[model samples]
Target chain A: MPSRDEIFEKVKTTLVDALGLDEDEVNGSSRLKADLGAESIDFLDIVFRLEKNFGIKIPRNELFPESLFTADSGFAENGRVTDKGIAELRTRLPHADKDTIEALAKDPRIENVEDLFTVNMVVNFLTAKLNG
Target chain B: MRWFWIDRFTEFKSGSHATAIKNVTLAEEHLHDHLPGFPVMPASLMLEGMAQTGGILLGESNQFAHIVILAKVPKMTFHSWACPGDSLLYSAKLIQQSDEGGMVEVKAHVGERLVAEGEIVFAHVDDAANGGAKIDQKNFVFQILRNVMDVGKAGNGTGA
Candidate 1:
């Protein structure tokens, strides 16, 4: 299995190719959407690239479940994620920064949930996926 | 002008690849209006031909059960120009496919000289379940290329 840094480098290269980002622009903390300016369609392209690069099969909805973030999912109330939502997100995004998710819950504006999808989050996800 | 860009499919393999040819003609009205004297076949139209070649391949993979639209163009590059009297051959290969969408890597060539190369993204819409509301269910793409597809089928040894 590749080391976490090795995996991160591959992930970073994939993001740079997929999203047309400069290498310096991406890092452990950069957000996929907010910081890196990835649109929803780019998610599909990124997943494809990841699968090809890692030779892994990722089933639909395994990562970046955009539908879950919608207001109608009962995951959030008044655009803020509720405790129930946070719990659900914990279950859903096990590889994400749990502390960040928890911290955001204290000031959980619904949009902030999207912030959990930073560069490190993907590296973490791949680390677990490959090591396991 | 007729939205159908490619004249016909020269080669087609279900769920894999397809090659279609378009014969650029000086008689095409757009060429007359596009610059009047130097009637070069626009790269944009050649890109459409590439998409059509790939789109039909994708749509037929699912038997055209869903509405497939050219959803995105992530990469495209033109290396040479195609002009009147030139035959543009568009070859498309399926790169990836999932339930919701598929991607194809396509190239447009004028007899060994590469004109353009790119990747295309297509989305499958289950109109009935997704509430497309007022989408044309007949699929304009299939409607236009129906005859050409028949020709391809006949040439494929279907004999009908």
Candidate 2:
């Protein structure tokens, strides 16, 4: 099994190669949108890279916050998710529920791109698949 | 036949890399029939644009040794929607190259926002051997692509 740092580096390289970004822009905290200026198409590129690099299949809906991640039940409005914000998404899986997603999104522990919970989910999934 | 999109080759370096552009407009006939109220360029067509770009690169690079046909799209993902009046810039770089086949990484964008991305794989085939006959370069395939794309020019008489 590869170390966490090794996996992280591989993911970062995939991002850089796919997005045509410089080394400085790819870091632990770089947000796909805000920090790296990744547009929608770029997001897809990242997903493609992730899938190819890790050899894992991430559902299309799982990639977007609007599709799967949501806030609390009471916080939801008219079947819409309200923002309590996610605190730390590291523990939450890509298919996790609204409250869990909210906690992770609000969590400061996910400060950079490397800190995203989805990456961990992907890594774990890939590791398990490869090991078995 | 009118091409759904048209782009100019801004940068072309023999076989290593290439860049092109596609202008989307409401005037396109496909848009009218694609969706009634919501008209957006089809993702498959966007991929075709990438393929064309990569194909030209491969043809030029290999000196037209084999006609490059898009064999497989391992993965493709779209992040945003592209509508009328959007100019998509496509750039492709050769990743792996050989006598028989190659792969290129391609990305499309509107302004600074990325719209779609995928890796295109191409297989090299002899025009006469595969098609069971010899083919002309200018008046055959390149001419057709030029006519469809309305680019009006061929790439150094190589894309037969």
Candidate 3:
């Protein structure tokens, strides 16, 4: 199994190619959307690149869950994610930064939840997938 | 005048790869105005041809169950260009797939010359939109694009 740093380096390259960012522009703290300007389509591109690069199956919505709190998801209401939604997020996204998710937990607004998915979370997810 | 970019699928392998051909002709109106004296096939249309070739491959992989939308082109490079009378060949390989979508690596070539190559990302849109609009991917795919796929049944690649 590759070490975490090796996985992070590969993931960095993947993000740079997927989002058209410079090598220096990305780091562990870079937010996929807020910092890298990733749209919904970009996530699919990222997942494709990561899967090809790392040779692992990163299931859809496993790394970057979208519409988790949609109107009919039973996890949100009036744009606010319910407590049940937050807990489910925690379970699904265990690799995400704890502090980042906690911040969202405090706010619990559906829009703010995307901020919790950072570069570190990707590294963590890959590390666990490869090393687990 | 029809929006069909690819003439026919030259090859296909469900959930694997497919190749199609496009016969660029000066008779097409767009080429006449794109560059008055130089009636070369636009790289954009070539890219679209690649997308259609790749899209059909992905759609067939799932038996056309999901509406495969070309979501993004993360990487594309034009090594050369095609012109009137050139039979451009587009080869697409399914690189990755999930319930959400699939990715394909596509390349355009004429004879032995590489015209263009790119990676296209496709997303499977749900049947119904939030506001009640709906599209049946299988039906729509068959209506406009099924002829090219039929080539797979009679020609080079595996059965559809």
What TM-score does each of the candidates earn? 0.90, 0.49, 0.91
| Runs off by more than 4 Å, candidate 1 | A70-72, B128-135, B139-147, B152-160
Docking class of 3: high
Model 2, position B50: C-alpha lDDT score: 83
Among all candidates shown, the one with the greatest TM-score: 3
| Candidate 2, number of clashes | 18
Collision pairs in model 1: none
* lDDT (10s digit) by residue, model 3, range A17-127: 999999999999999999999997888889889989988887767888885776777888788888889899989889989998788888988889889879999999988
Residue A71, candidate 3: C-alpha displacement in angstroms: 0.9
TM-score of chain A of 1: 0.93
lDDT tens readout by residue for model 1, B1-160: 4578888888889999999999999888888877667788887888888998998989888887766778778889999988889999999999788887788999999999999999888877775536547677565665566456875543657665
Question: Against the true structure, whose lDDT is highest?
Answer: 3
lDDT of 2 at B4: 29
Worst 10 residues of 3 chain B by lDDT: B151-160
Error of 2 at A100 (Å): 51
lDDT by residue for model 3 (B65-95), tens: 7778788998999998888989999999999
lDDT against the true structure, per candidate, is: 0.85, 0.63, 0.86
Residue B32 Cα positional deviation in candidate 3, in Å, after optimal superposition: 1.0
What DockQ do you compute for every candidate structure? 0.48, 0.02, 0.80
Per residue, candidate 2 scores C-alpha lDDT tens digits across A69-124 of: 33333334444333432322333343333443545445423232222434344444
